[model samples]
Target: MLSIKNLTKIYGGKNKAVDDISLDIEQGEFIAFIGTSGSGKTTALRMINRMIEPTSGSIEIDGKDVMQMNPVELRRSIGYVIQQIGLLPHLTIKENIVLVPKLLKWSEERKDKKARELINLVDLPESYLDRYPNELSGGQQQRIGVIRALAAEQDIILMDEPFGALDPITRDTLQDLVKVLQKKLGKTFIFVTHDMDEAIKLADRIAILSNGQLIQFDTPDEILRNPANQFVRDFIGENRLIQDRPNMRTVEDAMIKPISVTADKSLSEVISIMRERRVDTIFVTRNDGTLLGYLDIEDINEGYRKGKDLVDIMHRDLFKIQIHDKLQDSVRTILKRNLRNIPVVDENNILLGLITRSNLVDIVYDSIWGETPAGVDEA
Candidate 1:
């Protein structure tokens, strides 16, 4: 277990980057530090690894003070992964992964054996072992960055926005990879990210920070259902406030007006509408505006170039939530479908708006408990 008490970090003059934050994270827990810029989430994360010193506080791992150990020795035992994916461009994948074990004078056979084992664990081909970092894609490199952190067999790992730069598909893929590794290995993870959806999806509990103070630390479900203040609610975005309506508002209240096109539309027309709207998915409809399905660009990109019609390549699975249905009622269907956005329909089964994963994230976080977050702005 990791215990932090009265953790504080003050910079030049009187600026406190992290102020009196205290938390107790159980072993094998996956916790996230999330907030807007300069909320001290990153500061708090950095301090745990001693990359940034704390002005006043105590951090203990397994009942031992982290400060009492040698800095070099302490770091070697704690895995760290960052957004930049700081792999040495010149080093082979195997060599990069075993940096710490090499420092500890591990035998050549042992290092190679462990390296190959982890490579397989992440489902990477054995051929990747001899490849240089430059030879891999951004997603592949980030995967290497993550596995390298675990290469040393550290029970605790700290990741700071590790997937922040990847494309949405790659980011989602990596998040699933990390969650699988976290559960299979039973490792303790303190992840830092500004994306609330990422936090809600991965963390067992979230540690919300603002102005360097630990505002609220609880399960993802609780934080969304009951924010401590306006800042928390605002950071969660405007949709978080919808839970407090007297009738417990439905997806209709939070859904966005959708931009859609007919299935018969040419691929060019579909692409044009999507480009103009800057949207990832476009709903397909019939002449009467009846819902058809939706198109995922990736699933049909090649087909689109072959002059295939939108109807030919578009997804046929019709997943939607009714406008009158309470928000919580759709949580299971939304997440179970792993959809980016779902079509919202009215009583007549006419498309209304799009209920996106980004919007549904907050609602799902609290829906299980049927509690609304605090601080609903009555404007």
Candidate 2:
């Protein structure tokens, strides 16, 4: 656990890099500080570990005043990773990874074991242990830096743009790896980044900074759906699509296949299917099996009361979205139409699955929250 109270940092004469700010970070929580250039996100992070001292206020690590601890001991107790990675050029990957444990006077056997375990944890081949930093790719080197920081078995990690220098694909891969590692290790992470998208994806709770102060600190969904202020609203922007698209998510990611029902049946038959499936709509299809309309519960009931046939009651002019359409688009559609669910079809008009309003909301919430809510499907 970490706590900051009225923290302030000033450089030289008058430059206040970090203004008075305060926050509480729970154990095992991944909190990201996000802001534009010169917003003092990095400065705030550095103050926590005394990489940059605060001009006033206090920082406590697990209830002990950080200012009272020896700089070397304090740093050793907290892991740190930077944008440049800071891997030693002369050291092999194994040596770099074990540097902290070795410095902390770990046994040779212990250090060696930790090195091997960490190398594997970062997905590096065993052969990479003896390789120098220069011999590895940029992404590999970055992973080595992470392993080195984690080698000391610290409970708190300060990551300042750890994946900022890598390619997009590598960065995304590393982000996923970090999430996995965080879940397994349960360490408190204080991450600093200027990228909003990364903050949204990685942070359990995002703290937005501006003019050397925290503007908003809340779950990502909270910030997206209800920004704290004008600055936050402007920063989040109007295009919600960019904020909710999951790179790995597809039509199959959130579809409910079992709940889907076929069309072209009689009113009584469709009602039976709906009751059995516990669904509100059925996918209408022609005799040859082409999608023709959507038979909703209301349509079926109204048709039965009016003595109309299933064909007459079915919504032939129903709005449809492709399976590959962004989930956010489906969310907007549901919200606008006040619908319970939307039908997902392929390009050929073949039914795929139903996306309920709750499902779309869950996807958006998970996108902003950095983790799926309890009982929600992974996307």
Candidate 3:
């Protein structure tokens, strides 16, 4: 948890990069700071890890003042990702990933294990671990950048326009990856971005700033429904303002309970359950119902001889929808990706339900034949 109180940063004694901004960020929340260029979103983020010393006010993490902590130790204890990525080209992927841990004197075995674990979290192959950063594509390198931040197992992550340089498709993929990672890891994320769509899609709360001032801080849904002022409303864009439509539904309204198995289930046990359920793919979950990954009949058949558990052969690369997301978003993704079913999860990656093709079909039919509801207007 982070508490920013009267946080202000001034440049050359007059220019306020961040002016009297204050925020209370909860654990595991994805918070995005957004504004036009020179609005101080990045300055506000850097102050948290003491990358930029605050000119005034204070920052506290779980009641401990960040100013009182050693800068190097504080930074190492918190994850930081940036657009440039800054991965050392000379180091191998594994080495780059565990660089912080190594600097902190982590054991070789621990570093190696952490590297492998993080690579998997981003759905990258372990074989890539031996390759250098140059060998990877831009998107691959960015994925590494993201997981490397997690290698230290820090509870808080600060990202400054991390996906800004990538192509739109790759950026979208990485956005989904980061959102899922944040939920699965239960880490607090403070992200700086100028894109409103990105903020609304990935953040639990969006903090809008202007001329270094904190304009508004609220959940995306709340902001969409009720922006604080004309500046807040205009900044978010008129097109994003939601219409009061009672017919509108969220993914939670349509999702059915998912067919899932605990990760601890053996391959044989999963196969039997799948056979009985007549489902090709089943969500693999941890004991707490965290959606760990997914297993299909093909995976079971191939890995059966290896005698591994469902978790061992499960696919971590899969699309999922948040329960509170608009049903239209799910429909768009399912149709675009040609998916059979997508898991629905809460903010914490807890398995809530699943939206199947049948569910989407029904929603589509209703949308096509039912009365049209009002929508956001073009600016």
The TM-score values for the models, in the order shown, are 0.68, 0.68, 0.72
Error of 1 at 17 (Å): 0.5
lDDT of 3 by residue, 1-379 (tens): 6999999999999999999998999999999999999999999999999989999999999999999999999999999999999999999999999989998999999998898888998998999999999999999999999988989889999999999999877888899899989999899999999988788779999999999999989988788778899988888775444321212578888889889999888788888899899999899998999998998788889899887766678899888888888875566557756889799999999999999999777666554544545442211
Task: Name the lDDT of candidate 1.
Answer: 0.84
Candidate 2 residue-wise lDDT, 175-212, digit = tens: 86898899899998889998776787678999999989
Question: Which ten residues in a row are the worst by lDDT in model 2?
Answer: 239-248
Candidate 3, residue 253: how far the Cα is off, in Å: 6.5
Clashes of each: 0, 0, 0
lDDT of 3 at 331: 68
| Global lDDT scores for all candidate models | 0.84, 0.82, 0.88
User: How do these models rank on TM-score, best leading?
Assistant: 3, 1, 2
Off by over 4 Å in 1: 240-379
TM-score of candidate 1 on Cα atoms, chains taken together? 0.68
- How far in Å is the alpha carbon of 323 misplaced in model 2? 14
lDDT of 1 by residue, 1-379 (tens): 8999999999996999999999999999999999888989998998888998889999999999988888888899999999999999888999998988888899999999989998888889989999999999999989989989998899999999999999877887799789989999999999999988788778999999989999889987677778889888888766544533312567778788899897778888887888899987788889888898888767557777687877788877776778886565465446645767888898777898888888776454545444545544222
Model 2 TM-score, 2 decimals: 0.68
